[model samples]
Target chain A: MIKVQQPEPYDPLSQVPLVPPPGHYSASKLERVLRKGLFAVTAELNPPDSADPRDVLKAAEPLVEVADAINATDASGANCHMSSMAICSLLSRAGQGSVFQISCRDRNRIAIQGDVLGVAALGVGNVLCLSGDGVGVGDQPGAKAVFDFDAISLLRTLKTMRNEGVFLSGRKLTTPPNIFLGAAANPCIQPLEWRAERLAKKVTAGADFIQTNYIFDVDVFEKFMETLRKEGLHKKVFILAGVGPLASAKAARWMRTNVPGIHIPDRVVDRLEKADNPGEEGKKLCIELVRQMRQIEGVAGVHIMAYRREHMVNEIIEASGVLADRQ
Target chain B: MYAVRLFCTRHARAFESVYKGLEKVFLSLHPLLKGIGYNRLERPVAMIEQMSKGFLFDCKMCGQCVLSSAGMSCPMNCPKNIRNGPCGGVRDGGFCEVRPEMRCVWVEAWNGAKTMQNGLERIRVVQPPVNRELKGSSSWLRIIREKGAMKEASKRQLDPAKSELAQAFAKARKLEPAAVPLAKEPVAALAEQAVKEQTSVHSTQETTSQ
Candidate 1:
């Protein structure tokens, strides 16, 4: 019998250092923000549909100081907006803190490591690695999806790059990115316990922090936090629970039904439906969620995904009192 | 899609436990089976299973069946053949990189992970690259052998009883079985040959009811 060997496990992060080394690179500002014991607030910058850089600034204008740092989304919802790196480069230069998001859907490891260095050079302090929403969910469902590394594996690879000061090829880097690694979680996704266990895995993979999907269902989000706390992962990583405003009852219902990993309880929808001004009521509900999420023990901060409603983000953040605890 | 129901998924926790139980049962039989002569039926049965599954699910026979984990479609059907997730090359409207006409399998997997109760947890586990060793062989026997090896390794090495059993297995693996004659070509050609052989065999399997 010809004994054919089983394929060796193809771990991209194998042979890399298991733990981070001290003084490897400069630390990111968001890391300081979370470590300070002050509640941190992060908001996403909805890139303008046009190439105008001013549009990016204008979108970011309302979020300045109001948010500790703004996440520049990378082709979120599998739709093209201005590139997250481009906007983040501009934002970082403008002296506003930007958390650059790197989606594995777009690049291989070589390009991803290059982009990580590029963003660090641009003064972007933090990066959120995401296994982005499928292309079918976007305007162009015909695009090829390139998920080179899912969220967890990307975190591991990036951590190796920063700590080891070497590429995946074993070649040394003159300078590693002085950056904080982040990953995404969706607490409301089905098989609720799996979500928390995956969070523990990301933590094991060397994720310094996490930002979750929208928190319409804080009950579920709380349960997810409870699981993390039980696993002792809450101490190992910072979790910024996701919160977003609903434009109306219709928008809430649409998001609940169409979006993956988003759960909107019927009571919230009915509350929006019964309100005289559902738009304002939606913001109120979102504000309430932030307040509620802040009270959760493991939640270190909040990530506000306002979508197209970036202008109202400041009000939501202030009303939620996420920054009120800040020094 | 129908193949998915008949094989994996749709069973949830029931499927995982049954799969583990099958491995345990197979491992327990290894010592007894080592004494018997090589059975010719095993190879033919495995070949038929592979061919039928390949035909039905467009199976790459990744040897690791993620069909239930990835809806009914084969993730290997993706042009890039990424096991863990999708790439950005997925065209707008869920098009594939290599074949633009079809939906990307990983994209379908993401959608499935969200909707399917049985498949939801499988999405988070990172799958390894394709095992070439499993390509031409029966995954059933391979799974059994792999489980037996794992069981042996996990046992305390100081146990003299286990050492004797280990020696027996090593001896059994070293022994020569009667040789079967076939073309010494590559796997692709052998697979093609098997298909032809199967077709001829089935051709005579016509209706006797009439």
Candidate 2:
């Protein structure tokens, strides 16, 4: 029989806690992970277009201390980019927390299994499993997809390795990984009901945490939470809302109107239109959105997706009252 | 010739008596043999049997019954026995592990069901867990026989004429030839020789083409 332990009530409006739920991992161990995050924050770091790690490492320097972990994009939307694994290794060597974003596309089950073991061996524990963007949208349009497993299957595979010490093939691991498994969610894409249902599936598949798509509306997010509560999955996993600071109003509008899955509410667009400088206005809007997300009941954290504005992550976190030291 | 004639005369009378008795039994079993509905001899029985097997029943795995939900037949035939889901091993168009022409029965079923109006809603009902004790064991057969007996007991009150088609098919199978007599060795020898000649001629033509 599994023992259930109750966690201490957390205030998301204050300093965000990085602790795993009670009975999931030991409370002491969760405390250790949280202690590591006393001043740490995470920034999504996309890899450079060229093969060299010099430029990538240079780009990641300011984010190293301000952000706890530097998330490396595996293949952001199928475009040709430097390998995430190599960049992660470089970032880790440079004393940055390397959170590797591993996608299911372009890899078969065998390769995926191998990469998981390989990443664990390399001491990169944080992994985000995604059913990546289609090859048609990537730089290599002619390339074929090898969706040997979906995101849920990959999550299940990882959980099996960690908990049962067994691979998907039922082979025993020599040493089981203590990896923190994460997954992605698009709450803004489909009907609120379907989105909730899909999110429930992801949780059931054993996602330790979730990183959502860009947040443009807090009401839609709250509605999503309502549905999640109805489905009885509110307490199961940690949710990190994705927020990106727009470089300009044009970029914000493009993301809202042109992007397939992102929905930017009209109120946000109206606020951006009235501001003196759109970039500054967009940043302020992002900071406000982050502040609002922090007030949410079950949100564990916020994943700031600053697009090309990676440096502003620290400022936004500080302005939102998530980082107390700055205030 | 004289011996053959004597033997035929001696057995003819006995053979006629046996044939007459069998014909009487067959004619008594099915009155429908004389009518227009005669072609449906075994079809109705087969359909009833299939339905009794619970082939169209919803799967027990809930939250996402992708198979019954999708419209594909179950993947219980696959060794892994994945329900409401397909394994990573499925290839293009979601074919099964063993056969290519036969699409992943579950995927095909789901696709077919999804296109139909109100079809997806039918899958929302709960399916009971598979009674594992009734699978791959002798007890299953015993239970089936017991149930069949109970059915027979209840069915006895119905008119015998109502089940005439099933009775006729059973009688007809018994009357049909069980096995054809083997022709003499000369025919087998001729067929084997013909196959060898054809292979040799094909090989020669291929060599010439090369």
Candidate 3:
């Protein structure tokens, strides 16, 4: 009988300290942003179709001073919105810390490379690469998708541009951008054990930070953190729990009925329904959730996503006592 | 007499299979040639061996790893590895550099990753540069294909019939005879038949019976 010898598991981390090829840029900005730990806060600002960046800029301003950076949504919710890069540029010009959301849905490698270069030129240092929402969910039903590269590929491309100082085509860049790279996660939706594995993959793929989907239950977030700690990934990367103000009763109901990935608990629903004013009640509930999440060890920070109720961001942050030390 | 030695350092399995198949046919036709008369055949065999080794080095550009990780096709074999390129000559889906059956590595990788569970979401995260170190090390091929003498053993036997027979024998050895109750086996068979009959009757009643 022949004895089978099991090979060692492939450890990507074992190749740490492998320097990128000469002439490529380093993702220093991403490293710096994660290390600074100045209680980073970012808000989502969707772009408008028209070249006019009025609404986005206005939406971004109030939170600009308080937030370390503002995250502009790229055709958020699968709608035919304006380019996130353009809006991010406008926000950066307005002196707001801008994090540009680059989705893989609209562009191929050429466009992604070009856009990354363009954004860096504009001095927008933060970038989040997302495999954009499916075209089916967008207003433009028949719009074609041009997924030339996935998120990991985009990350690899960016890493190449930064470290190798060249695009995927091997063309050298004149001036590489100092960009902070981030990715998203949904801990509540997936099986508890798999979340850490997925997060580890993202980290291996070079994601500096993770912005999670809206977190309604702190217990689930705690479980996620426990899993990360158990897997020894808790200390490796920064994770910002997503919290959003539920807005009106209709909005709460809409989120429950419409949002596919988000999990809004029945307890939250019952609280919203029982309150005389659903908006205020929802806001209060969100504040408590954030406060509980903030207390969890290994939590880097919280990203308060107020959905359309952007104004309540200040309230949620204040109520959570996150602003207590800063003020 | 000049002696020629043929060596296949890589992809030894497939190459050995072809060599053994040809050897079998040759021996069948000329049994007397096996003794020492085939020393002259070594030169042509060595040339064929070299050609096969060179051919194995040509990248197939399957992009399995690329698709699983990046959502982009592999550009390892493509001259440009253009994320969005036809180069004006990519006909149907195959690149001009490779076979028609092989689609553009990048396109196929993107499609495969997109279909995997949570693959689309993971695709959103930015990827690091392709470790061209993957090229320098012969490790990728080494990891996929069996190596050394084991690979030679695998190639020598093209069919799995003997292995199948051994597996069947092992299974038969593990099997234990069970005492069956007189009514149990017949009753179970009757129940199965009854269910099948019921299903047929239900299907017939639902259809027009034409």
**Which candidate comes out best when scored by DockQ?**
1
Question: Candidate 2's residue-wise lDDT over B1-210, tens digit each?
Answer: 223322322333343354346445544543343242322332343234334323442222211122323333433433233332333233334554334454544444344444544334522221211222122212112222223333345554332432322221222112211100011111112233464676799999999999
Q: A73 in model 2: Cα distance from truth in Å?
A: 1.0
Sort by lDDT, best first.
Answer: 1, 2, 3
The superposed Cα distance between candidate 2 and the true structure at residue B121, in angstroms, equals 11
Query: Model 1, range A213-249, lDDT digits (tens) per residue?
Result: 8877777777778888888888888889888889988
* lDDT string, candidate 3, A246-280, tens digits: 86666766764454456666777887888998888
- Mark the regions of model 3 whose C-alpha exceeds 4 Å error after superposition: A1-34, B1-210
Q: What ranking emerges by DockQ with the best candidate at the front?
A: 1, 3, 2
lDDT of 2 by residue, A182-223 (tens): 788877654343456556656766677778888787888888
Worst 10 residues of 1 chain B by lDDT: B175-184
Candidate 1 stretches greater than 4 Å from native: A1-26, B1-6, B9-210
Model 2, runs deviating above 4 Å: A1-41, A325-327, B1-66, B71-210
Query: Of 2 and 3, which scores higher on lDDT?
Result: 2
The TM-score values for the models, in the order shown, are: 0.67, 0.59, 0.59
Docking outcome class, model 2:
incorrect
Q: Candidate 2 chain A: minimum summed lDDT over ten consecutive residues — where?
A: A1-10
